[model samples]
Target: MRGLREWWRDLTDLVLPAECGGCGRGRTVLCPRCRTALSGAAPCRARPVPEPPGLPVVHAAARYADEVRAALLAHKERGVLALTAPLGVALAGAVRAGLREARWGPGDAGAVRARGPVLLVPVPSAPRAVRTRGHDPARRIALAAAGELRRTGTSARVLAVLRQRHAVADQSELGARQRLRNLAGALAVAPGGDRLLCGGGPVVLVDDLMTTGASLTEAARALRAARAGAKSAVYPSSAGEGREERKAGPRMAGPNEGGGVIREAICAAVVAASPDSFEINRN
Candidate 1:
């Protein structure tokens, strides 16, 4: 089934060759200039206004403007799957910057091996959005990012364990506060997800773009809830376990041991963030 799907997609692409999503250049999904634009010189912090509670510190590879914006829309809304590779490369850079900011040390083999594999958890897409697009763009980019991370000696893997627990209204027309209200309590961790997060490596939420940051904030909440639930299950109210769980905090711990109550994401990475979020760094 997978092989057939791959062949069909390849054939479809050949039948309808793509132009650069950033520019109108023919015969390419993304031009070199646009790819470079997507990949900023360095990853930088991106914060949305009225940042929601539980929102993690975010890093983005580029501002969501001009070519970057066009490219993201093309890949996400238009199903230009070929753009995933370049976008993933951009995301990988942002993830690396996040790891550095979090003080995970160098990407050397020894350092990465010692730290185990970081988990890239892509923010879940609404069911309606996924159905309309016919593919989950965030997950595809996340998979590519993980591959890119592995090549750079930073052990990483994608864990798509977040799911929407309820429906949400379209967010494009909503203001920041409205978006927050709409998304609150909309997401939850899938069964068995907490075990993966407890694997002693930091969890970095991945997204294609971030505007108001409500989604990421909600995702962090879901993950923390899952961790807490898992810990409670194992500890079962023993005094010693309670003490240990309390000490665990939000830090990732060994799979066998509980990590306490997760309150926020370690960090988040995106292909781009709103242009306004980059202003401080620009100055």
Candidate 2:
């Protein structure tokens, strides 16, 4: 069944041909100009207004505009699977920036060396959306991003451990606050999924784009709750600090302890972020 579907998709692409997802140019999956635009000048911090309580700091490769916006929509909505490689490369750039920000310091040799097998957790797509698209776009991009990371000497791997606890209304027509309300309490870590996060390298939440950041906020909430539960079993004292950190707002991982592990997310990275979410560094 899967093979036939793959064959059919290939046939369709061949028959209709394709244009660059970014520019709509003829006979190319993505043109060079659009590809460069997708990569951005550099990954930079982005935050949504009234950011959700557990939302971690996020980095984005490019602003969601023009070529970047078109490329993302084409891959996500139009099923341009070939664009995943370039999208993943863009995502990898953001991930590297997130990792750099999470580092305690350049001198922390142990933390630097111990950062291995980092987990790339992609946000779960709704089952209905997955069925309609005939593919899980976020997970595919994450897999490609992981490959890109590994090739660049970071031990990264995609771990799709998040699952939707209930159905959500389509977010197309919703405003920011409405989106948050609709997604609240809608995601959770899969059963026994906490084990993957325990004592492993930092887990970075990943997605193709960030709008209101409600989705990533909800995802971090689920992971942090699970991490607190897991930490109580190992480092009971740190549990209080974890809760405190949540109250303070989004935080990246701090210095590592001798035996205790900081299980919270280091940060988040995405291929693109809404233009309004860009934070100018004034200092």
Candidate 3:
């Protein structure tokens, strides 16, 4: 049934053809030229930008201008589902780099087990936006990144832990400060977030873009809060269980476990970012 559905969609697509998303060339998902532009080196962290307290360190894939911005908007806003694959590839590259940074001091085999798992938690979009887009874009990208990580033998998982606690005004028209204000009380960890973190792993925040980084900051705060709750739950239980606790419980913990230590450890990656679009006076 699914095969037939896909075949029918393909046939329909062929009949009323659309141009390539990356290049606007007739009858293709992406043209060679744009693909060439996109198929460059892996993305890295940009210079630090101030974010809300305890926000994670962020890395972006490409400057959100020219071809990159166009490609991102084309896939995100338009019904360009095919773009997700390549975009996911780009995102996966950043995830790999972030994971490497997180896991760098690791040892092999038994020693590696001491470090625990890596969790990728994506910033949540508004419910209305998800409904209108017909997909959760960040989650979709995170899943792809997780798949990529698993392929490379990293135990990565996606935890959609962040949720909107309040409705935020539209961010498009807001300046940086306005964006931060709009999102001030807008996000919280989902229920069961504590258990999710307690079970195992450090958390990495994921987002599609970072302008003022207000959204990512909120998400990081939520994840850190979850990690703290997770650690507190473990201690008394671990003490109560005594020596037996070591056998059954998760060995490693999330970022907030040690010294209320958030690990400076927070890392993030995106497919693109606003290119010097932020004005100092706009602050």
Backbone clashes in model 2, listed as residue pairs: none
**Candidate 2, residues 195-234: lDDT per residue as tens digits?**
7776577788999989999999898888887876886677
What is the full ranking by TM-score, best candidate first?
Answer: 2, 1, 3
Q: Give stretches of model 1 more than 4 Å off.
A: 1-17, 105-112, 236-265
Would you estimate the TM-scores of all the predictions? 0.84, 0.84, 0.77
Q: Rate residue 198 of model 1 by lDDT.
A: 72
List, in order, the clash count of every candidate structure.
Answer: 0, 0, 0
RMSD of 2: 5.9
Model 3, residue pairs in steric clash: none
Candidate 1 lDDT tens digits, 69-152: 999998999888888989999999999887766656373446546657888999989888999999999999999999999997
lDDT of model 3 at residue 247?
41
Q: Identify the runs in model 2 with alpha carbons over 4 angstroms from their true place.
A: 1-17, 104-112, 235-250, 253-264
Candidates 2 and 3 compared: the better one by lDDT is 2
Tell me which residue pairs clash in candidate 1: none
Alpha-carbon error at 223 in model 3, in Å? 0.8
